[model samples]
Target: MKQLFDSVRVGRHALRNRLVMAPMTRSRAQFDGTPGDLAATYYAQRASVGLIVTEGTQPCADGQGYLTTPGIYTDAHVAGWKRVVDAVHAKGGRLFIQLMHAGRMSHPDNTPHHRAGVAPSAIAPGSGMFTAKGMQDIPVPRALSTEEVRATVADFAHAARRAIEAGADGVEIHGANAYLVQQFLAPSANVRTDEYGGSIENRARFAIEVATAIAKEIGADRTAIRLSPGMALWGIDEGEQGPALYRYLVTALDKLGLAYLHIAHQGDEALLADIRARWTGTLMVNRAGRAREQVGADVASGVADLESYGAMVLANPDFVERIKTDAPMNEPRREGFFGGTAQFYTDYPTLG
Candidate 1:
């Protein structure tokens, strides 16, 4: 069995282990989309992990979906993230900022400029989002014109550059969940008849362009992307063609020579196998709710180069150490999962 403690390399960084810290939204940033003050401490405390993929950070103003979620577009945003990158690097960790654009999964009130959400089509996600006041129904977003779509792609590239400037080892384009990139990938969320919609190639164009642009801005070695093959969250349906779409998309992305393809597997072993076969680059798998005993099963099975964990890493700062020693882990406080202080963020006890 390939142990989780084994060291690995992804892109340009040499990781200490095969355990990755998956990106997760904590909603603890400043109201202006700057990462919270404790962000440095929070990430640094978990630096023992092989790789840290930070929360979904917006690439542009219209990308803001949740309250206090960070962004990398502004000067302040870059400066704020520098502290986080410095802190993580100081502890001998590699960090990747996950660049996210929320698309139709957003509310005007949640954004810094209160701008309307944008998507490939003007559709509502049929979901409610948490705002400053309370949970509010998501509104129909304006469909991005071909020009706007190009601009959005540029925005991702710019954000990736900013993340690099902030001292991050790399950036992970958030092509998963029900975000903008996935909005384009899912037929239900995309009803456009333009070049960016309709056929599978057209639907996959936006994500490819975003990734290409980021790779060009930085190096292909420092560019990575996260994808969820058939996530139905927020009313997104990739259709029965979902599996095929991913096969085509992954093949195209694989040729780009990206750092790694992080797949948030949603229980489709066949599809996962297909993606693994199609992709030649490094592969990282995030299987939510996997038991403690099965932590490194994917790596051991040769299906994944790295295995990512969220709640376990969130609740246990010394998660890698705990796994090595078979030590008891602190339970994650569900109530303090979002918009909280150090109580649950940086205060997670490490095995001492």
Candidate 2:
């Protein structure tokens, strides 16, 4: 059986263990979208993990969603993230910034300029987003023109470069979670007939272009992508074409020869096995909401190169040690999961 402590090579970085800290949105950045001081300490605490994927950070102003999320397109943002990178690096950890474009899942009140959300099509996500005025129904987003779409791709490339400048090991395009890339992939959210919409090939085009551009900017080995196949979250559904869409999408991305492909497995072992076969490079699997006892099974069976945990790592700074010795885990505070300060963000205790 493959052991969780076995060393693994994920692209250009050599990991000491097979434990990964999954990218999670904690909404702890400044209102201007810059990472705050406590952010560095929070990430540094969990540096024992082989790999740490930072929370979903907006690649551009229009990409902002929810309250106080961080960004990577500005100088201030870069400097803020640099602190975080330094902290994690000092503790002997590798960090990858997850560049996430919220698309239509954004609210104007959540951003500095209070800009309207942008999407492939002028469709609403059929949900509410937390804003300055509290939770409000998402509005119909303005459709991006062909030129604007190219600009958005450039934004992702720019953010990837900034992440590298901020001392990150690599970058992971957040193509899942009903965000911009996933919005285009889902038929219900994307109603455009242009090159960026319609057919599966077209829907997957944006994500491919973004990934290719980022890879070109900072080598293919330093680029990665996170995808949640068959996930029907936040009223974003791909309908009857979900499985085929991901199969086609994953196969296309596989040829890029980028870094590891992080998969948020949603209870589909057979499909995951199929994905593992389809994808040739390293694979990081996260069984969302799985019990602690089942965490290492994916790695043990050779189904995944690494395993990631969210709530476990969120509550336990010394997650790897806790897992290694079967120590007690701190219960995650639901209320402090978002829009919180040090209490839930950086105060999680380490094994003494």
Candidate 3:
């Protein structure tokens, strides 16, 4: 059995352990899309983890879906993240920046340009997004032209390059949740008749292209992607063939030689098993609400090479130390999970 504290190799980096710090959206970036100053301290505080996947970051200006979320597209954005990268590296941590585009799950007020959102089709996600004013209904997004789709693919590649320039160990394409990539994956959200939609291959095309482009920009050994098979959040429904779609998608992506496949498991044990069987590389599994006692269960069973934790790592700065010593963890406060000062963000005390 692989213990949670055991050292592991993920892609081109040698991780200290098999515990990964999962990506979470913390609305702490500057209005200009730069990361908060304390972002470095916040991430460095949790550097004891084997791998640290930074918060969801927009790849372009229009990719913004929530106010104060970080971006990696601008020179200022790169400078801001460089500090975070240096901080984590000083603490001997490996970090991966998660590149995300919110798609139709966005509000005009949330973006600086106040432009209409873009997706495979001009469909509304039928959900609300957090804006400066408040939670606002998502508007109908404009359909991306085939050329624009190609351009957006380039944007992801550029972002990956920028992340590496900023000193990040790697980049993780956010193909999960209700983000842009998954928006294209979901049938209900992507009703286009173009080569990027309709059939399973079409729906999966955008994701595959984004991953391929990133891997090309940065080495495949430093490129990874996080996926949520059958995720239906914010009006995203992959339909009845969701399982088959993932099986096909995972198989295709696996051949790309990506560093790792981080799956935010949505409770399909059978499908997860199938994915484990198809993927020959490193697998990072994030089982929602996974208990402390089950931390290394997947790794022990050979189902996953690593396990990712969001809230647990957020509340426990000494998460790796605590797990190794069997110490009690501080409960994460929900109210402080989003935007806030160091009060809850980096003030979580570690065992002294």
Candidate 4:
């Protein structure tokens, strides 16, 4: 059985252990999308993990959904991230910048130029997003032309190049949650008859193209993606065909020979098993709200090559150490989680 502490190879890097710091949204970046000044210190503090997947960063300006999320498409964004990459590497850690496009999950008030959100279709998520004006209902987004769809894929590719320029080990395409990529996958969110919509193949095309473009710009070994099958969020309903869509998507993604497939499992054992069987690359699994006792269960069972942690790792800087010693952990401060100062960001205690 593989242990959680076992060393493994992911992409071109040989990781020290199988514990990955999952990508999370901290909402602490500058309003213009540069990473917060404390970003370096905060990430370097948790460098003990096998890999540190940075927060969901936008590939372009239009990709920003929530307030103060980072973007990688600009020189300012790249410069800001260089400090973060240097800090993590100084601590002997590997980092991947997760490129996320919010699509219709956005509000005009939260983005630059106050432009409308763009997606595969003009449909609204039927949800509200927190802006400077407080929570506002998300408006229907502008539908991208087929040409614009291709341009969006280029945006992801451009961001991947910029991530490497900022000294990141690689980039992970955020194809999960109810974000742009997931919006395309969700029938409720995507209703176009273009090549990017209609059938399972069409809907999966956008994600596959984005991944392929990134892999081409950067090496396939340095490219990765995260997916959450059957995630019902922000009025997203994959319908009964959701399971089939994932099976087709995973099988197709496997051929690219990218670094790894990270799955944010949504409680379908049968689908999870099917995904595991179909994907032959390094697989990282994140079980949200996973308990302490079940920490290494997936690794021990050979179900996942790596296990990712979010809140526990966020609250405990010495998460790997505490796991090794079976020590008590600190509770995550909910108040300081987003758009905050150092209180809950970099002040988490470590075992002496």
lDDT per residue for candidate 2 within 47-159, as digits (tens), equals 99999999999999999988899999899999999999999999999999999999999888887778889998888878898777777998889999989999999999999
| TM-score to native of every candidate shown | 0.99, 0.98, 0.99, 0.99
Q: Using lDDT as the measure, name the better of candidate 1 and candidate 2.
A: 1
Identify the runs in model 2 with alpha carbons over 4 angstroms from their true place. Answer: none
After the best TM-score superposition of candidate 2, give how far the Cα of residue 119 lies from its true spot, in angstroms.
0.7
Query: Please, what are the lDDT tens digits per residue for candidate 4 over residues 186-239?
Result: 999999998899999999999999999999999999999999999999989999
lDDT, candidates in the order shown: 0.94, 0.91, 0.93, 0.95
Q: 218-334, model 1: which lDDT tens digit per residue? A: 999999999999899998999999999999999999999999999999999999999999999899999989999998899999999999999999999999989988999999999
> How far is 284's C-alpha from truth in model 2 (Å)?
0.8
Residue ranges of candidate 4 with Cα displaced over 4 Å:
none
Clashing pairs in 4: none
Residue 269 alpha-carbon offset, candidate 3, angstroms? 0.3
Q: Report the alpha-carbon TM-score of model 4 versus the true structure.
A: 0.99
Q: Clash totals for all models, in order? A: 0, 0, 0, 0
